[model samples]
Target: MFELILGLPLLGGMVVMGSGWGISAVMFALHAVTLLMSLQHRQSFYGSAAGIVTCLLFSVPVWGMFGHWITAALLLVSMVDRYGAGMPGSFRRS
Candidate 1:
């Protein structure tokens, strides 16, 4: 599920680059939904780790403006996965 969620944006980016605007839009939407679902289930450490890595992967500046959205989505997923469970309490206290 996580793989699919991550893959969707990447696939969508590629499709959009290849000129499949309509399918790419649909894939982008699916990617966002799946990423949300993955973050919602990030009880396991692996999920959190994967989320972080995926986010970093999108930060590379080599990706053109068109692909920047993929970066945004990955970062969003990572943030939710990392802190979605309420920041583990240890770092939450003021």
Candidate 2:
């Protein structure tokens, strides 16, 4: 749920890179907060960390879009895996 919410800005940025630096700044802050929350919950933080990196490189046009795509993909995969592992009778590899 939170991952999906975080992904909205990334998708929006890809469509409109001209939204200015303010959006990127806000995203950076959001990612930072999310990272802290993930740490508190002991959940995976890779997606939020990647989001911070993406926000930092967001002014580079091409690289920014690429980063957004990669971050979004990472978030999606993490969300799926988190939920999958919680399912009953799911196989766990150690």
- lDDT string for model 2 (1-94, tens) is 3323333555655544555556677778988998999899888889889989988766565566667777888877767666766679986533
Question: lDDT of each prediction vs. the true structure?
Answer: 0.46, 0.71
Q: What lDDT would candidate 1 get against the real structure?
A: 0.46
Weakest 10 consecutive residues of candidate 2 by summed lDDT: 1-10
Candidate 2 TM-score, true structure as reference: 0.69
Poorest stretch of ten by lDDT in candidate 1 = 58-67
TM-score of 1: 0.29
Candidate 1: RMSD to truth: 10.2
Alpha-carbon shift of residue 6 in model 2 (angstroms):
11
Q: What tens digits encode model 1's per-residue C-alpha lDDT throughout 1-94?
A: 3333324556544644566445434545555565677559643233334334443444332332224444445555655655564655544322
Q: Which one is best on lDDT?
A: 2
